[model samples]
Target: MSTTIPGPVLQEADWHRLLLLRATRPDVVARAYAERRRPGRLLSERGTMFLLAADHPARGALTVGGDALAMSDRRSLLARIVAALEHPDVDGVLGTPDVVEELLLLGALDGKVVIGSMNRGGLDGATWTMDDRFTAYDAAQLAACRLDGGKMLLRMDDRDPATATTIESCAQAVSELAQQGLMAMVEPLPYQRREDGSLVLCKNTRDLARAVTVASGLGTTSAYTWLKLPACDEPEVVFGATTLPCVVLGGVPGPDPEQDLRSWGRSLTHPAVRGLVVGRALLYPADGDVKASVDAAARVLRAVQPSARV
Candidate 1:
C-alpha cells in the first residue's frame, strides 16, 4: 500500500483556519453544504459501498480500543476523516449533524454519499440508554441538507421498556425517509444488560437473526430500508434472517487484523450483502495506518465482485 496522502491534509494550521472561519464567517458552512457534489447512486459500478461511520461520538461512545479518549479530539478526528475520504475506494460518510457540518465546511464531502445519523439521544452509559430518541437530523433536515440518507441505531433490549419507544421512532423515521426516496439505514443490535447494569452486545447468532427480522419489518414500507450489521461468528445466519440489502460494519478492529479481514471478505460473498459501512477498523487501525487499512478493506470488498448489481 502507498503511504502518500490522497487528499488535502488538515494540519494544525488548517484546523486553526477552520476555527477562524467558523467564528467569523459562519455562512461558509452553509455555502459548503450547498456546493457539495452529490452522488447519483449509493453503490459503485461493482455494487459495493465503503462508507465512513463517525456518529459514535455523538452518542457519547468515543472510546476506541484501549484508548479511552481516542476520538476526543475534534481536530484529530476530522483529520482522519479527511484522509479516509480522499481514498478512491471510500464511497461516503455517515455522521451526526455536527460532524457532517464540519466535514462539509472542510469541503471533504464532495461527490460523496452523505448520510445523517439520527436517534443518538441514547447516551452510552446512561440508565435510559435504550431510549434512542430522534435528537439528531430528522428526515426533513436530511432532505433540506441534500444528504443521501439517514441512519439510526436500533438496539432492542427485551427487558427495557424504552426499547418500545425506540422501535416506534425508528419505524416513523423509516417511513418518513422512504417518502422522500432517501435511504433509511437501520442497525438492529440485540443487547443484554450486564449484571453491573451496563449494556453489552448480544452477538449470539439466534439473537442477531431475531434482531434482523425485527428491523427488516420496522416501517410501514420497507422500500428504502437498509440493514447495517456487524459480522458475527455465523455470518451467513446473521445475514440469512433478511432479504433486505445488508452492509457489514467493521466493529473495533480485533487483535488479529488478518482474521478481521477474512471475516469481512467471507461476509461480502453473501448474496444479500452489498458492501461495508465501517469506521474504527479502517480509520483507527492497529498499525495506525489509516490509508493502508482502508485500502486493505477496499480490496476485500472488491474481491467478492457480484455478477449483478443490487
Candidate 2:
C-alpha cells in the first residue's frame, strides 16, 4: 500500500498561521504534544516500517548532492514532509524538536510513530564536530512530549577524543530510554577526519562492523536499543556484529533510482534489518515527484518482504 500526495493542501496563509500560533501561544503546542493520539505500535502487522527522516538539517548538514541548501527552506521542507507522511506506506517521521513540534501542532503526526532526534550539537564542518552533545530532546523530555522514542547519532572516530564524550552521552541516553520503556534508535557511523578538517563517514564493512559492536554494548541494557545503520558492502557481515533490530538509513539518492532500490532490496533480505528510515531519496527524488518516489520505495519494500504483515 502507498499514499498519494495532495496538491497544495496547505498554502502560504496556513504557514503564517502556524508561525503565528507558535509566536502567540506556545502553550498550545505543549498541549498538542500532551494530548495528540499516538500509534499503538511502531510497526503495524508488517513488523517493518518506512520512516521519513528529517533530522539531517538539525546537524547543519542540509546539502543534497550539488545543492548547497536544499533543506534550508523551512516552509518548503515541511510541505514535502507532510506530503510524504500522507503516503500509506510511509509510517512516520524522525526529526528535531522544532520540526517535530510543528508537525505536532499541524496534526500531521496522529497515529504515526514519531521519533524525536536527541542530539544536534555536532554542527557540520565545525572543528569540534565529533563532540555530538545532547542539545535537543532527552529521554524525560520525549516521555513528557509523548513521543515513541529518541534517535541519536554516535560517530566513532578512533583518532578524535571527542568520540569519548559522544559515546558516554549515548550510553546514558540508551539507559534512560530503556527505563522509560522507549526505543533508543542509535546511528553508529565510522568516522574519519579528512585533511581539510571535514568529518566523513567511512563506508568500509569492517569499520561499520566495529561501530555496530560498540553501539550494541552501550547503556545498561540492550533490550530497547535499535541500530539505524547504513547499507554497506557485505551487509550481512556488517549487521552480523549485533543482534539488535536494524533499519537501513537512506543517504542521497543516486542518479539511478532502480539501482538504489535494488540495493535497498538486497539489504532488507538480511534477517536483522527491519525497515527503511529514508530522507532525501524519497522526499526529494530527481524527478521531483514525491508521491512517485515514495510509491517506488514502497514497492521495493513490499517486493523484498512480501510476507510482512503490512
Candidate 3:
C-alpha cells in the first residue's frame, strides 16, 4: 500500500505535461492526431466501372450526326450520353467535365462512375504541339463535384521538353489522386516528330513498352491507376506491354462498323484488356443511330468478362 502511493502523482504529472505541450504546439499536435484517423472511404460495390469513350472533342473530331464538333453541341451530346447511361450494361462514362457536368445537371450521374478528362489543350492540329495543358477538369475539381476519378493523356515527344513537362505534371497528378483514393487513368504514347513538324504516335511493340514503363514508374501507389491504351497496330504487341488493366481507345471511326466492332471485341478478349473506350465509332456512327451503336459497343464490353453479363 505504501509503495503504490506514488502512482496517482505520476499519472497527474504526465497529464499536466501533455496538456502543457499540446497548448504550446496546438496545430502540430492536432494534425498528428487527425492524421492517425483514416483519410477517407472507398466506393462500394454499387460502383461499377465502365469503358468511357468520349475522346472526340479532345481531338476536335466531334462529328456526331454529320455535325462537325457535334459533341460541342451540348444538348445533343447530353441526350446521347443519357441514353447510354440508361443502358443496363453501362457502368460509367469517361468524358471531359463539360459533358460530365451536363450529365450531373440533368440528374443522370447518380450512382454512376463519372471520370473527368483532365487534358485537351494540345489540340489535334496545334502549331506549338506537345504542350498539352491541363485544360479540362482536375482532381480537386472532380472531388468537389463528388466525381469518381480523373484521366489524362500523355503523348511523349522526347524532342519536345513541353511534352516532358506534361508527363511530369501527370506524374504528380497521379500521386495526388492516389492520396485521395481515386482512380487516374494515364494514357501514355511514345510519339515521333515528323519532317513536317507533326507529331505521330507510335504503336510499335518497343514504343508501347517504353510508354508502359514510364507510366508504371509514376506515382506513390498504383492501386487506383489504370491504363487507357490504344488498340495497337498489332493487338499482341499492346497485350505484351503491361499486365496493368487496360481499356482500349476508339480512334476515328472507320468506314466499316462491323469490322471495327469485331476488332474491338477481339481486343476485349485479351487477358489484360478490360474494355473499349470508343467515342466516334459508337457515338458518331455513319448510321446516326446512337442507341444502336452504343448497344453494340456494350455487347462487346460485356463479352470481355462473361461474369459481367447484364
For lDDT, the strongest prediction is 1
Q: Could you list the CA RMSD of all candidates, in the order they appear?
A: 3.5, 3.8, 18.2
- Per-residue CA lDDT of candidate 2, range 11-99, in tens? 77779889999889988988989887898798756788789999888889877656777777677678888988998988899999999
Q: Which one wins by TM-score: 1 or 3?
A: 1
Q: Evaluate model 3: give its lDDT.
A: 0.67
Model 2, which residues run further than 4 Å from truth? 1-9, 306-310
The RMSD (Cα, Å) of candidate 1 is 3.5
Which lDDT tens digits does candidate 1 get at residues 1-310?
A: 2222222236777788889987999888777878899988999878888899999888888776677777766777888899889899999999998899888878889899999999999998999989998899999889988999999999999999999999999999999999999999999999999899988899889999999999999888999999999887887888988889999998877888888899888888888889999887777775667888888888989888667355
Q: Given candidate 2, what's the lDDT at residue 252?
A: 72
Per-residue lDDT, model 2, residue 26, is 86
The C-alpha TM-scores of every prediction are 0.94, 0.94, 0.77
lDDT of each: 0.87, 0.86, 0.67
- Order of quality (TM-score): 1, 2, 3
Order the numbered candidates by lDDT, best leading.
Answer: 1, 2, 3
CA displacement after TM-score superposition, residue 153 of candidate 1 (Å):
0.2
Error of 1 at 138 (Å): 0.3
The TM-score of candidate 2 is: 0.94
